[model samples]
Target: MTTDSLILPIALPLLGALLATALPRIAPLLGVLTAALTAMSGLWLTGLVWVSGDLSIVLGGWGLPLGIGLSADGLSAALLAMSSLVGLGISVYALGYFSGSERGLHFWPLWLLLWTALNGVFLAADLFNLYVMLELLGLSAAALGALTGSRDAVSANLRYLLVGLLGSITYLLGVALIYTAYGTLDIGLLSERVEPSALVSTSLVLMTAGLALKAALFPLHFWLPPAHANAPAPVSAALSALVVKAAFYLILRLWTDLFATITDAGAAFILGALGAGAILWGSWRALRAERLKLLAAYSTVAQIGYLFLFFPLLQALPPGPARDDLFAACVLMAVTHGFAKAGFFLAAGLVQKKAGHDRIDELGGAAQSMPATTFSIALAGSALIGLPPSGSFIAKWVLMQSALETGQWWWLIVIALGTLLAAAYIFRVLSRAFGQEPTPQCFITDARAEIPALLLALASVALLGLAAGPIWSLLGFEGVQI
Candidate 1:
């Protein structure tokens, strides 16, 4: 009893992964085809979710407790589509990205596997199943991150893998607690059964800590910069854009439904405070970083900080127009940032390739030389800075309004300051790129490399001025005014 709707997006790549593995040499070509098919199906399935409320598939003809299941609500499908789009872009960019290597063959399979895990986790309505997928994702990502063959890459990935294991174990501990307390791991049923108890509260705290670290929340974000900064470009893009986000999406679901009415207000505030700190600290590092990739990595640290800031706001609002506005705003922030940040990272990859290094101060006169790539980076940076006509702008506006509605003026202040800091760091790079160098490097052309970067960047910017009607619709929340 597979929901034909849910089956295609998840199943196809899985089968493709097997095929690509069997062929070995067709890894690159097959990876692209697989990701492209997944993206298209992701888009189509999202449409099905919108037209119908939610789509679900039960495995092996057993229902509920005895069987596994996948479900797509508005939120799940939107993320699926985003993952597909970003995954496809990563695949295309990787064609020029990994090029020729004994290592490249291994990269394609692991990457597609990562994408499958991401989409699976989002659609998973089963708890233990999600845990299994999480483990798969962590292992694949760590393997991919270590692919560069550089000592630093291996070292950073080792640390990353260690941190990731701790987080997963913590999350698993929470699941064990829930199963012990409630006797079921089905999310929908658990939502109905979840109740406040000493065990429930303890489990909540444990899960929160684990997911926070995985999401690279401040104080626990120590592993992110090193891993991301040291990883290769395509891997870094996937890690930053999609991998870190998987955990955050889990946190959102936990807080929104499972924690229903049992919100630990004090804990929510603590996360918010740390999120703000991450914004400041990460932005400061980005402003100071001598290397392009490190700058982008730190920017991810800052951007992800913004993602967690919504937890407190969602907890504070009453579930009505106020809460819905907060939800929409947060969703907008996540999707918008996903695209923009990925674009920024990909564009940075091209810049590093052309300049032979990514030192900001040394990048004088790049604007005249690599206008397509540079402009795309600058445009993607605009979304990160919350400029108007961008989805981030609209999202931030709604978030600010939510703050005002709740009299959370301090939250308002923090948002404003974060915007200014983001602008400062983003402009630092742009300004350095445009500086008048006595001798601009006559860089060789690689349209194959630059085109994908520009297309992704343009998509990020287009998200601002244009409507997200299709994307939002696919998520089943179109015209979903609160």
Candidate 2:
């Protein structure tokens, strides 16, 4: 593939958003077609990255400091592929969920806009471009989250919008500081020029702090649960599964890639501590949540905490196979959660629609009435709990192994506690699936809606679980054993 192919993933959805906005009468058809094409382009780019090493392009034939650059390595390509797959699933689910509604008209454009931002983030090669993409992402996300128009949805998303703006402004301040200290906004240039100085340290701290808030890490995660729980189903899926993950991806990039020289074990430890707190606190809240969607939202907070746990371990290990394994495990955990959580939210939305409410206590007969959705939930919940033959299981196993190898055995206890809590919350919902109601005659009530959930959930278990070796290859560690 040529370097120009890099722009297709970002451009297709952008053009689709504009077309969708102009032609609302055919918005759904345009949205789905655009989503399919974007997914194809993303996968094609990922394939090129896998075959070659990395790809970079400066738009409009301009060089650094004057041109906008887009680059794709294993990290960005993996995320691009994840976003494409999960995004397509969400688009398909939205088709049946929003049938014959005016909200569908508005949803297509905003959703495509969000997709554009997501792809831009993964491909951006400059810090200023990242800020611009992040701003667009936050605006589209907040708007999509409030699409239901209920009082709660509006109130929660308003807070989300404000918090998101705060994060972007703080991040921009760091970008400005870096540009002042150095001479360029390109990450490649900045990385080469950055040195261990007060200005650089301050810039890293400000950027990490801002990104942690956006990623909903521990104490800064106060705004997440309500916003996710109150949004429409597809919106909720994208918010919890893809949106927050984007912020965390930026944090990982900064910590491991751009700012790797200056970052030390002490800073990594602090992040790991916050992650431990989030794991315990978020899981506990999820177990006690009364609403099903609220439970899933809290679970997302906890799952994000698990990703942070790897930072300390990664910092402790030197560059070798051990560190590579741990890093790959972290990515595997992230990709697994992307699929599992999206599937869980989609299935939960179906249950809510059928039951007319999402209360965990009153979902007995409503859950049993739809066998396919219930099964989807069961599969996804197993993955969430890190059950055997699931992607989370492999990731956590590698995590614990690295913890032991690095003499950070205390983290094993935190992982154990988090796993137990995850199981409790997931099982609590599954228990409600078994009721005295009569069995359904068929497995699937709606193929358009149910199949996407099932396929996504199965991917979490079967695709990522058994075929996890590909992840190591995708990350450019071909011979490493999982």
Candidate 3:
């Protein structure tokens, strides 16, 4: 299929979101079906690219230096696949997940809008276009974040909104810088044109800082934990799994296309330093959190740190060596983390719903009764903790080797320590839920609620040790070092 062929994947949800405003009664069914179709289409698109090389679709008839465009290489497609599947999972989870809420009328529309923004963010090709999509994504996410209407939810959403705007403004300034310097905003065009001038350096800083803030990278992540924990379960899963990733994807895209040309020693150290800080700070907070949702939310801050740490990993290229394997590791980590974190949030949400509170001390032996959900949490936790044979384990292995190869061994230490932190927080929750305290469930979230989290968890586990050929092949991009 042509790249344009999958345009419907982006269009369908937006259409549904619009339709939902008028037909809230049918919004749940429509949203669920649209998500399923989008995921299926994404799978089909990925298979198409894998067998037939990559695809790009220019908006209208415009080419790269002129009008906006959309492109899909293996990396973009892989993330698209993640969004597709995760979106469907969130949608289904939303169905039952919303039943408990008295606000389904508002939930369905915002939820569908979020799906649209996610797909749009993944598909965007031009720098300016990405800004627009990210802005749309930001507004919808903030609106969705505030939907729960609790004091915490409102407070968190307000913080999230302000922080998101700050990031957006910074990113836009960077976009303007790029346009002024090279007169091109298309990534492919910028790739061919960018040079190591003051303008390029400033733009890189603005863009990276903006994306880091949006992705909740450490030091700039103050808004993430409360924002995520205060939202409804499905919403939290979507925010943690997909929304934070939008900014990370932007950073990855910018790195590959523009900054790759200016790759040098100082920038590498600075990015790596931030990544190290995020790993330590987020993990420390997660360890101290007394509640499950808060713990998972903080863990997201830490996991996001792992994504930025890839900056150092890719930088480890021996001046002129292949960065393909390293870049692949970064993509795999982000994708794997997407599934693992989503599953973790969904499972946490389940625990909170059933227990009526997410406090760790009160969650006594509920896991035995909710065996399947508990098991899902454990399996997902395995991936998060980077246990052997999980996707995250392979990501860590690749990262460790890359760090060792380049002699930047401090990041390796961070990975090892962060993994242990991941394990500690996960174990804290699981161990408490092991025996039979027989707390009567304050509420029972349905099995439909359970399946999305479980599928995403299974996906996280299955990602580990995935046949190398598929992922390796997906790393293909034209005329790039990695």
Candidate 4:
């Protein structure tokens, strides 16, 4: 509501992380409280943006290129709202997942710190601050992923940490190039100042490459599955649903906003080609995956590919209602995945805990025993497969329409193939629930664990799918014809 409130979403979690680190005994309590407050703050900021257009403020009243700034527009606000809702669900699920365990001592502080970085990334106004927030995000995410202390967890997260650092260094080098050429780091200023040149082209490639590694785009995605699958359940949810999204957000921002003038159809086609590879390869790998969480992780890689497929379409289309609708659809897909994936991971975690293992081939008893969790998986899987009544279904419909309208029908084949593969893998997992194992009497055994997953899944299926028009309004689009 107020300009000062922009800082609360970032500040509250940061302070909570400090307190949680200092007070290990009650860290979970502090963590949950902070999560609630941060979610509320994020929602409030989003509401203000929806009511009033964009909002920005210079911290410390120093103004412009010298002082720190925070801004929220439609794109940032939509992501913030998604992060808030998904993050709150993950936090509540963590409460039950880590109950009375030593893991909670470390999980709370690191998780809160990760939340702080996630918020900071979404709301960051400048490139340098984005890099700083990204560094913190990487460190915190790597730590949280290794909280299980398993050999595999530790090793995977170490690779994650190193890869993340490599990404940071590459991105920082690009930032330095931009600053040297333009004399400013503020995104708003740089957007206006950036011009087509070798230096700018090189910087964009460096930054995009680095972010691609973090986002796990196909060939660069070797590090994601192991890292995501090895983390604790709640940590896995955060990593799959939120952490990688932060990197992709930056890529989207730079491509569509900052470097639009220099970006051409060739560059967009290259990215789209890589995205096609990711879709086929990632989905094929998911179909063959043996573990439940590993499948979810690989599915994430495929889901990310869908976002990139929009680039060529975006580049090909002129700025008009068609382009605006395509852009909004891209955002809608990302937000839908955020909630759907989080719910899927949370429910998968519950099933793993109940089954004592997460092997997809051996989950019959666990799936049958927890009807609510099984149902959660079903709902989330529908979204992943782009089935009707899920947000992804609508987004894909628009996407295919645009592909046909633009005369680039090749993407339609990729989308259809990916959807089929997704359905195959999702149904493969769902099939395990209907075996010889007897069903439980009640639908939900644990309210604390099951409700969050159920609600998040339901939102993806019902809330976002049926009511996605607001996303167009939020993004300042006139409205999609479809």
Candidate 5:
């Protein structure tokens, strides 16, 4: 049953993609149904993990060295759940977003394929399998990013494709080196068999660099803003919310599990330093961005910085409740940003659709004309800003607590500065709503499009924030020192 649950999320979306490609007329409905089923399967698996334990399955009963494996630990399960839920919302929004257009047919299939790759990445237990999934994800995402048919969209995604291929090639080479040394690609087997050596360090650097490029961490993020900002709204949401995190997830998986014995404070601190640069640089750029989507895109760079900041703290703390809290907090922050960014991009899409442009200064009328959309922005912004009662607020709290506890108070200053910048930029958009403009005649301009944004934002604030206790439990941590 556990294996069935794990496979269903990936399989269903692949099936849906084929179905959508074969039956274009019913693509929208098919996408919604497929995404909903996938979400249900992921949620069920998460529940099973929470109630039971982590699951591992080898394909075709060929266990271990000869077979491909899929495993869902608490970490993978949480991410898989986030991907499915966000995907379902995006699918619904795209139905109205594409609305009887020829592009809708293309959108459904690519989006479903992307969803499949996302699930596959989270569940993949071997390095080689993860590489395959990441390539599929990159191709599908790049294709979807170019769906707008604008020259900017096409050019940006073309660059994105080339960069993704480069990153994948580097990552595959690292995998090859490791496999040659260890005679295996299974993450579990490698973790047990591997030892610290020059070969291992080289492989780590190569792999981490490749994954970091994909995660859009700091200087490597050059291709992200344009690719994300110019994509269709639903595509933008998925790209920002789900796609980049997949790479980061693999990085975290390797750093914490497979390479733990070989990793050290110095290496973790170096990554954290890059994260600090990302926070400062990305936030400054976001504040200066004239366009709404670009601001959101830059903000993704900053939020990703926060995820990397966890490493130093994790390294400084010894294994215990404190360490567990920091680890779980990282997952919490990633998932919170997932929901919040998805909502922000979806709401930004609506504003762009109605106003015909997304210039932040010119958005007064569009922001005011749709109260629900405005509210969605506000809610998501609060999460981004780490305002109270949002999941990000809780995550940030835990992060700061860990930092202070470890005597690394320097990170507190970084978090504080990022928080202030987040508030300023977020409210910069909300201030547009206060300007003189005719109010919305109805609370919803389009329920199909607006509701998903509202729901995702609300989840980030209320559902995730108030109920985060379950997250620790879901992650299989027993201590609650935080």
Candidate 6:
């Protein structure tokens, strides 16, 4: 039942993409239907995992060496659930968003394809298939980023495309090396067979670098801000909230599973150092950003740094309840940021549309006009700032606790500084909401668009944080360790 449920999330979106391209006029209806069905299927799979634990299936009944396999563990199920809910919200928002534009027709097909890719990445059990999913995801994302057709959007996304190609090539080379070494690409098989060698180490480096580029880690993130900022709001939301997470998921999977025996303190610390750089650099840039979307884009860089900061601490501890708690915390942070960032981008889009610009200073009046949008920003900003009761707050607390417990006190300093920087930039935007402007006739403008943004924002702080205990149980952990 769980394996059957997994196929629907991937298949429904592919069908929607074809239907949307063939029937552009009714694309919005098709998109909503796709989102509803896909989201339901994802939820069903998550429930099955909760009840039955990990599930795997090999396509065509050709088990092992010749078959494509799909698997859903607690981690995959959690991400799938986050993507489905957020995807559904974005689809509804897009319905009101693209109503009168030619780009609207282009959006549904490309977006659904992107959705298909996200699902594929989460459920794929083979390394080579993950590479295929990454390629499709990259192509669709680059195309979507260019939907605005502005000079900046086109040029930025072209660079994004080139970078994505380089990443894919590097990742594919690593996959080839792995297959040549072990004669198979199954992740579970690799975990049992992998042994430390120069070739294996080099392949690990190649795969990590490729995924880092895709995930926009630190120095490799040059293409992110421009591409994310210039895209349509829904596109921006999807890119930051869903697409990058897929790449990072692979990196985490490889490190924890296939390369676990080979991981060392030096390598983990190096990764954490890069994360520190991203935190300081990305936050400083976001503080100085003049435009709202660009600020949000830079914040994504900083938020990703927080995710990576979990690595060194994870490596420092032995496998136990403490380590498991940190692992679950990192996933919770990623999921929380998914919902928060999506809401932020959607609200930013509305602000840009109404005010005709997203300049932070000029947005004072625009921010104050729509109560719902402002409220959405406030909720999301709370999460971004790691304020109490937000999932990030809980995640960061666990992360810092681990850092301290492991005697790696330096990371705590990094977290503190990053938290301060996050607070500064988040409050910078929120402050504008108090500026004088004519009162809005209602808390919302188009309920279709604003409500989705509001609901997602609310979930980030409320549903994910206060109720996140189940994340451990869903991930198959013994109990809430923290």
lDDT of each: 0.84, 0.92, 0.82, 0.92, 0.92, 0.91
Give per-residue CA lDDT, model 6, range 41-118, as digits (tens). 888999999999999888878868889899999999999999999999999999999998888999999999999999
lDDT of 6 at 125: 95
The positional error of residue 181 in candidate 1, measured at the CA in angstroms, is: 1.0
Candidate 3 at residue 234, lDDT?
A: 86
Ordered list by lDDT, greatest first: 2, 4, 5, 6, 1, 3
How well is each residue in 212-255 modelled by candidate 2, as lDDT tens digits?
Answer: 88999998999999999999999999999999989999999999
**lDDT, residue 67, candidate 2:** 97
- With candidate 4 superimposed using the best TM-score fit, by how many Å does residue 97's alpha carbon deviate from the native? 0.8
1-482 per-residue lDDT for model 3 (tens digits): 36676586677888878888888778777777777877887777788778777778887776567767877778878888898888888888888888755587688888878887787888777888788888888888888988978898998899898999999999999999989998988787788888889988899999989988999987899999999999988888899989999998888888766678886678867877887898888988998898888888988888888888878667658544447777887888888888988888888888888889888877787776688888878888898888878788888887887877788877877887798788888887787788566344333467889878877875665454332445554777343222
Q: Give lDDT for model 4.
A: 0.92
lDDT of 3 at 131: 86
Q: Can you give the lDDT of residue 269 in candidate 2?
A: 95
Error of 1 at 19 (Å): 1.9
Tens-digit lDDT track for model 1 on 1-482? Answer: 22666877778788778887898898999989998899998988888888877888787779788898888998887788789888888999998887787677988888888888888889888878888888888988999899887999999999899998999999999999989998899888888888789998888889889888888999899888889877778888899989988998898888897777577778888888898899888888887788878888888888888877787888888789888878978888888888888898899889888889888878888898899988988999999999999999999888877776777768776777678778878887888788876333333368889888877876785553344666777778756343
Candidate 3 weakest ten by summed lDDT: 461-470
TM-score of each: 0.89, 0.90, 0.88, 0.90, 0.90, 0.90
lDDT of 4 at 299: 97
For each candidate in turn, give its C-alpha RMSD to the true structure in angstroms.
9.8, 9.5, 10.0, 9.5, 9.6, 9.7
